[model samples]
Target chain A: MRLINQRLSPGAGAVLKTLPFVALVLAYLLGSALRLAENPNDKLLPALTTLADAIDRMAFTADPRSGAYLFWTDTLASLGRLAAGLGLATLIALLVGMAVGMLPVLRALLAPFIGFVSMVPPLALLPVLFIVMGLGETSKITLIVIGVAPIMVRDLAQKVLDLPREQIVKAETLSASTWLIGLRVVLPQVLPRLLTALRLQLGPAFLFLIAAEAISADSGLGYRIFLVRRYLSMDVIFPYVAWITLLAALADYGLDRLRRKLFPWSELEGAR
Target chain B: MTALSIENVWKEYGDQIVLENLTLEIAPRSFVALVGPSGCGKTTLLRMLLGQEQPTRGRILLDGTPLPPEPGPDRGVVYQRYSVFPHLTVLGNVMLGPELQANRLTGRSFGAARRALADQAREMIAAVGLAGAEAKYPAQLSGGMQQRLALAQALMMKPRVLLLDEPFGALDPGIRTEIHHLMKRLWNELPMTVVMVTHDLREAFTLGTRIVALDRTRSRPEELLRYGATVTKDIAIWPPRVAGRATLYDTEHPQAQDDLTAFASPAGTTRQTPSLI
Candidate 1:
């Protein structure tokens, strides 16, 4: 069979997808066994049992000092910040992006500034955000927003600009005012694109959130990970990192589902 | 009913003039087709009529009043594509104009008002032969059906003038013929003037009660910037199809009578036996 023409059955495709993941686990186990066999006291490559024990200690058991499960607490704290930052970013991106896109005066005023801000490395502004907003939850949330909002705004504005000019002209002929045009013609179409932009910004938002948490947070996944690094708790650190990755993946899947549910017409557009 | 009068309109984009010294008097219920080759500014003139682009010079009067500077519900337009909003379903798209007109703030009607709007929209949809596809989005519709929905959407506004920029140019031949009949029926039924722009001469002859051809007198690149396209031929259809009342013979230009002799049927041919169709 030709390579491009070859097709996999559903059962075969499922197994093919699992093979690499299973192989990675097997490779890790083999390496851990070899390292442990050489040095019984080694903390670098803990056995699977040690990792499972750490998961139980962090997740099931309560911390002696705080009397709360650190893993659950950290997850909740991080998730709360992520939601707030993302929600704020979405609102700002919609309003400012629509203004910059639909109005020539506003586009001239803000489009260049947004482009310049988006070009700046968001991580470089972490210190400034922390200093201005302080070391509270506000600073951490602001870091995520500052990291993602400009890019999201730029993306949504471009989406608006790329819309067919005929649609706007048609809307105007329908007696639509400027505000009505934005609300009816532009907003509904730009919404799906906004969700897409939000999906793409998730990874960067997480990076900024973790960076902020690692720097000065009292309780978060990143804080917990950085706090235990001195003691070299690789077992707990590995599970925390995996947990974060799982959360991000789940959020991405949920957003994709929401977009499909809300804007089914966009699927036919083959929009990115 | 509304009549449109264009007096010596000129459209120039910087150094390049698109249209020059164009003048036309569109009757109250006439279907005037602006036919031209590409870049000859038939679409530009249509855009000017639709209030999308203002004439760089000269004037356009609707019902003897100066046209509003921007597009309004007083005029409706259908393009070759993107005439309907994809985000809205067939019913929603049809009702949008009325909804926005009734409620400026929300652009929506509610309760009994919305129900009434839906009924009118459904009636318009049925008029365009799209009765069963109310819930379907524009993306779910075929090109012909989308154009039908666009016609319904534009008609829902009941504008004084309907501007079509090759509204059926994107449809297949079979669909185009079907929609041409629908277009003719709508023009006959509604009280509005139509100005359509098409590159297809057969389409112009098939649907237009009067055909106006535009072309440049000069062809050189340097002359192209200095000179612009103007009306080269203006021919009125024989056995004239007028709606509501008979049109007087004075509307026909005697100078263009000899121009359409090559395309028209023989002198003794019946009214139904025109060669252009």
Candidate 2:
């Protein structure tokens, strides 16, 4: 059969799905083995045992001075900042986007401003945020909000605008007040789109969070990764990087599942 | 019963004109089907009646009073597409009108009130033949089922005027017939005025008691913008089909059924009745 026409069995498909991952792991193992063979102590590529030992020390054991589990603490701190920033951004985007999209006066006033702001690189505002908000949790959370909120707002506003005008007219004829139209009509439809926009913005949100943490944080996943870099501890750095990647993947998966469960209509064929 | 009057209404968009010097008096409980060629401002006239667009030159009155500057519960509308809220389930869509009207701020009711509303909504849904699909979203429905749901949603509000802007224009011939039956039944049962815009003349004859046509007198490119559409023909169906009157169509008269079957068939296959014109 032609390659395009070939269909994989379920078991074959599963194996094929894992092939690239298996290849990657094997290649990493081979590199580590080769590096360790040349030097008894190589910090570039730690062996599996060294990586496992680093994980145990960071996760199972508490920090001797602070008496806190470093891995859990870092994860909690990072997750808290992410939740706060994204939550605030979600609320603002829902409000501002709906207003700009639905009301002509608001659109005339704010659309241009939002367009301009969305163009400005959010990372460039990091120092400004720090200088204004101070070097606390607020600054880190604000960085994520500033980084993701404008794009989210723009996306949500466009989504609202793209909605068929018929629906709005129908709602009006149903005797919905402007406020009720926003709450019942526009809000329900935009929520799933908002979740989708958030999923797309997660990578950038994390980037800003980490960048802000790396430059000026006492504790976080980014803080730990940057902190251990000076010691040339590839073992810790490697595990932490892997852990971050796993967390991001898990978050993305969870968000997608949530969107499907909450708004199954969105997943329907031809639904926008 | 509510009567609507459009007094020399003209809708102009800057230099371009859409509707010009339109004067119409629609009786209470009348089914007025406005038909015309595309871009003849038929839908534009419907929008003006619904208060979505204001007439630049004249006033529209409902029940001897000026229409509210905006669309209100007094007027309900269904469009060719997007008539139902996609996010809402069938039951929710039907109940939305009463719920929003009953509670001003939250648009919700609680406990016994909510249950009562749900029961009413379920009854309405069932009336439109969507009894078992209460939990399904609009997107889950076929185009025909969705139009049924939209009909139920609009009728639940019990508006004084029901405006249909090609509500079944996108449906298949078979489904359109089904919806036409439901629409006739609803008009017979309800005490509301209905103004429907359609491109299909057969559909207008099938459902409307009065048929009105809009067209431009001058079609020249230079004159297109200079002349807006006006009512070219005003027709009242013979043997006067009035609301609350059991029409032959609703009674399943043998001849009416034959006409419908002919209407459903491919064009030019069978001779249509003069009444169907």
Candidate 3:
């Protein structure tokens, strides 16, 4: 009976947790059906049909066995771009965040600049970025930095500031230098929070990356979406959007799992 | 030689005065406890002595040199809250000071100093009864364990003096007593100039070789209250025996007994006077 009760408890919790997602899916389906029923010739049905056809075309190749490899290659190219952009941003963000967080006067002086720059949308800066950096990978990567750096810097700064006074005081009494205190005591405390922040910024980074690629690049999934959109080919556009969403969700889940693995003491899951 | 001296120290917070013309001297290898009511400037004085804050009117000196502008390993301080670094393992926190100073002092790489500092940290942790917990993080430990880790970290540097501000005030009475005994043991094992501030009078009397009482005036208005009593190194000088006699007489007085009987039934007559000894 005890084992049965334990088994039933988790099932109930899972259902409760999934209720919101179920509601969202139901709402989307109902809204689409209503729109199609009202206007039989509406663009919505054609867009969905085009999306279905695109998936079918991608699923079956001239040689069915090679279709999987083609899909894999395309996926890898998009994933590789994301990984590079994210890796560069993480390195830059961690370094800048530590520097700004450690030095009080520097943080104060640069806070306004970070705030002002973060307010400017990434897409709005595309033209200026293109003029300055050109329409290469540099421009897109630069866009990702401009879009993500400020958020990371702000989150990391706040996290550092939020550290308990006692921890710093403990270090001070031990005659620890500023660098020692930062490297040993402060960085370890801040890293887990920064990782969580990076995960939160992942969605925005992808959005900015896609926007940059769509406007200026000749390759990338974003570029393909734009090409299909020009001819009103919803088939290609819908599939790409779904692919990006799925990838974003997977990446976010993986990062959250990593965060838990690293800092088991944190109560972030309860926070969510 | 005087290990620490505070001459005519005055501390003010903008307009409000926290300490006024306070003076103290601590001899080497002595344990002194500073007892006071809340807001009597015990913490402020400790901070001033540790060089965390500067006195407004006077000076604090260590071994005839004026206190430095900021805290250093020469004076180790343990706060009421266990201030162990939550991120680093027990050994990491303990070795941090020596490793940092070694690099600056000798221009040696951190790798060169790591093994020696780690050995020292391990020894200190074992001394503090945390021998097996050296690899554990602060959060993984209990409150008592965390405080012990803080003690180990502070003592690992082998500071000339140790300053503690209500180090056991946040713990439950049982844990507080245990920590107090541990502190006394550590003090006996390695004699260094020590100054501690505590609200618990029993703690002060139990652990202190010399007790400096603050805010005694409010407790007794008619008699000239000794604001501070520095218990001499000789234990015979403690006032507990005399104080205990007076308390017993007061409790046994006819009027006192009558009042107690009025407050309670005849069953309370068996109550005895509380002992501070």
lDDT by residue (tens digit), candidate 2, B164-222: 99988898786787778888888889999999999999999999999999999889999
lDDT of 3 by residue, B1-277 (tens): 2378878777777755566667677777767788766767778788887788898888988989999988888888888764766656788777776766666543223564677668878888887778888877777777777788888888877878889888888777666656765776677666467888888878877777677765523334443232322221223224432211232212322211213234333444666667899
Cα displacement (angstroms), candidate 3, residue A4, comes to 25
Off by over 4 Å in 2: A1-8, B247-277
Name model 3 segments beyond 4 Å from true: A1-8, A17-43, A46-53, A56-81, A264-272, B103-120, B214-277
Per-residue accuracy of model 1 over B181-205 as CA lDDT, tens digit each: 6887788789999999997888888
Model 3: colliding residue pairs? A50-A235
Ranking by lDDT: 1, 2, 3
Chain A vs. native, model 3, TM-score? 0.79
In the order shown, the candidates' DockQ scores are: 0.65, 0.76, 0.35
lDDT of each: 0.89, 0.89, 0.71
Q: Model 3 over residues A155-189: C-alpha lDDT tens digits?
A: 88777777776667667777677877787667777
Preferred candidate (lDDT higher): 1 or 3: 1
* Ranked candidates (TM-score, high to low): 1, 2, 3
